[model samples]
Target: MSLRAILLITLQQEPGTGYDILQRFKAGLAHVWQASHQQLYRELDRMRGDGLLTCETVPQAERPDRKVYHLTAAGGEALDTWLAEPLAAGPVREPLFAKFFAWERWPADARRRELGDLHEQLTQRLATYAAIEEEWFAAPERLTPAQRAPWHTLRLGQRLTQTWREWIEEVLEEGE
Candidate 1:
């Protein structure tokens, strides 16, 4: 989903600021949608201008004023409509898979090093997915069934990483 769409989904829960949206990205959407702070802020502005969100300036005691965003009625309607539609399927564009596909030209040592690095990265990623899965199971009610896109995306990441790790193990064993 687009950043604005994700922001709309979040605003459905409560009015929130740009920083809050960024926090959500770091806390939950780090895997599914890799958006920079700049990208999110820019999208927020565009979404507000397009009448999808309403912004309110909230005064802070020690910090600068924060602009809280809420989804407009139109935004809610849009989100509901989009959620009811079918999602597009795309090819898996994994960097490690691409690297492995072109590995025939690399020296044996280089291939071994690449596989080692991939294994390390996948191991860490698996840990991340496991943590998210725990959190998802802990409070299943906080998120709507249809709005669990980030968690669903995390599951996909888990499967992909696990498969790659298994393949890496096989490759390393064959090279022995």
Candidate 2:
């Protein structure tokens, strides 16, 4: 999905300054999409220009003025339209896949070291997903409709990461 679509989704529930939106991205949307600070501000500016979003300048007591963005009617419609459209899978460009494709170029010991590092990274990612599940979705049956959507997305991520971790384990064992 495009960053524009992601921004629209984020601003739908509430109005937020750029910083506020970035914070939410880190906590909520990082798995779906990631953008740098500059990229976010640039997209926000473009959305404002397109009349999909409205920005207001708010003055703080001791800080520089901040701009808060609110989704306009057009923005909501755009989100709805995009949501209804069939989602095509985006391109998967994984560097590790390339590395493995040329596996004979590397020594066995080096390959083992790289696999070990990758395994650790995936392990950490799984731990993070588990913690998020524990804290946010401990009782899925009790969640509101709004909350259920995100919980399902989290579950999808967990299963995908788990599959990758399992494969990595098998490959590592084979090399051992």
Candidate 3:
């Protein structure tokens, strides 16, 4: 999916300033789609030009005017159209898988180190998800209708991470 589509869904979820949108990506959507600072700002402007979004300038006391993006009617329609279409299966571009393929070339010690590093990264991600759950989703039953989708996505992330971690542990144990 294009950054434009993600931006549309984001604004549709809750309109906010550019910084607010960036924070949303960092907090949640970054897990699904990654975008650079420049990509986001440029896309927001392009979306505005395309009439998919409207911007409102709010003056601050000492800061530059904050531009808040609101989804236009066209943007909503675009998002709806995009949602209705079936997504094609994307290629698995995992570099770790490539490392697995090249396992014979790397020394055994180096392989262990790589596996250890991956395990550490996955553990850290799980910890981050746990933190997010504790901070925002302590009580899933109380989530608003709008929050349900995100909550489910978080659960999915946790499950996927656990599965990956388990697989890594199995591989490491087998290698010993």
Q: TM-score winner among the candidates?
A: 2
lDDT of 2 by residue, 50-72 (tens): 99999999998999999999999
**lDDT, candidate 2, residue 38?**
98
Q: What is the C-alpha lDDT of each candidate?
A: 0.83, 0.89, 0.88
Q: Judged by TM-score relative to the true structure, which candidate is superior, 1 or 2? A: 2
Q: Give the alpha carbon lDDT tens digit for every residue of 1-176 in model 1.
A: 67777888778888889889888776787777778888888988998899889999999899999999989998999889888988899777777677666677767898899899989998998998788778764565688876576667787889988998999999999993
User: Per-candidate RMSD vs. true structure?
Assistant: 3.1, 1.6, 2.0
The best candidate in terms of lDDT: 2
In the range 1-176, model 3's lDDT, one tens digit per residue, is 89999999889877899899999887878667789889999999999999999999999998999999999999999999999999998887888788777778878898888888988998998898888888778898998977777878888888998898899899989994
* Model 1: ten consecutive residues of lowest lDDT: 132-141
Per-model clash counts, in order, read 0, 0, 0
> What's the residue-level lDDT of 148 in candidate 1?
74
Off by over 4 Å in 1: 136-154
Clashing pairs in 3: none
